[model samples]
Target: MTKGRSTTWQERIDIVQYCLAHQHDYHKTADHFQVSYQQVYQWVKKFEDGGQDALKDGRGRKKAPEELTEADRQKLEMKKMEY
Candidate 1:
């Protein structure tokens, strides 16, 4: 969290997307986002490991996807059939 300016959750996500789309121009991106070159690199890394979700407000750690229990899934399918 650098000083001077702060970005919203959506803004951070957009910055990551922009960095991924323009990886070849790292300096340009740094200037556009008003951040350092290393920050741009970090954003690209986050996008690569995960998708847009990685850019959101959090501890910057990825939690494994939750899996539905076998019984729960069966119940859901049964309910869907009734509709």
Candidate 2:
């Protein structure tokens, strides 16, 4: 969404979902999502405090992680597990 980062909406949603499902364990969520713990925590905070709109990457605001989408990340992990 930003110049260097390309975080997707689904990724944001998935991150928040995973964190919520895991009882808001930032470190574990971060590890499972392959992102920084702080990122997971911030996403949870944003999701909880602002809902879906908050996860949106607003222009002129701080950028989120720029890597694989949720599906891609999950697929990659599945592939890794297969190997």
Candidate 3:
């Protein structure tokens, strides 16, 4: 992998597979993949519970629009008129 900090989904899966084939040895997996032991453990757990989908970033996260009060709309209209 490059010097970039983030790893790709495929890379995570490969690491998980290696760990699994090695009898779930977290420490060896981490050392072999240049990652933390905890990371290996979490990835395996996520993979087991949710398959590859769980390994993706922002699994359930979403950006929601900000809620605006009526007063906020009035202020926006005033600002538009001033422009």
Candidate 4:
């Protein structure tokens, strides 16, 4: 496995597509992309489960109200009331 490196969203999508195209060969994909095998595997899995949108880097981003579950919305409301 190669050392993982930062990849852009488009790169991740490309990697996932490549892996899928090659019959989910994670090792080959990782080697070709110069990323860790685990990264290729995980990206492919996420894409399979949720499509391209799932490949986004979502860290530190707040969810929109509509994107939250009912329970989560209620929790947010309670926290707002506390403040």
Top model number, lDDT: 4
lDDT of 1 by residue, 4-81 (tens): 366777787777777667754777777888877776777678868887777676776654335667777787789999
lDDT of 4: 0.91
The reply for model 3, stretches above 4 Å from the true place, is 1-4, 59-83
Tell me the tens digit of each residue's lDDT in model 2 across 1-83: 11223569889899899889988888787776677777777889999998999998777864344656888778777999999
How do the residues 1-83 of candidate 4 rate in per-residue lDDT, one tens digit apiece?
Answer: 48768999999999998998999888888889899998888898899899999999999999998899999999999999999
Assess every candidate by TM-score.
0.55, 0.62, 0.65, 0.75
lDDT of 3 by residue, 18-81 (tens): 9999999998988888888888999999999999988989857653335667777778779999
Model 4 per-residue lDDT at 38: 86
Residue pairs that clash (backbone atoms under 3 angstroms), model 3: none
| Alpha-carbon deviation at 81 in model 3, angstroms | 14
* Number of the top-ranking candidate, with TM-score as the measure: 4
lDDT, model 3, position 83: 100
How many collisions between residues are there in candidate 4? 0
Question: 1 or 2, which is superior by lDDT?
Answer: 2
Clashes of each: 0, 0, 0, 0
Q: How close is candidate 3 to the true structure, as a TM-score?
A: 0.65
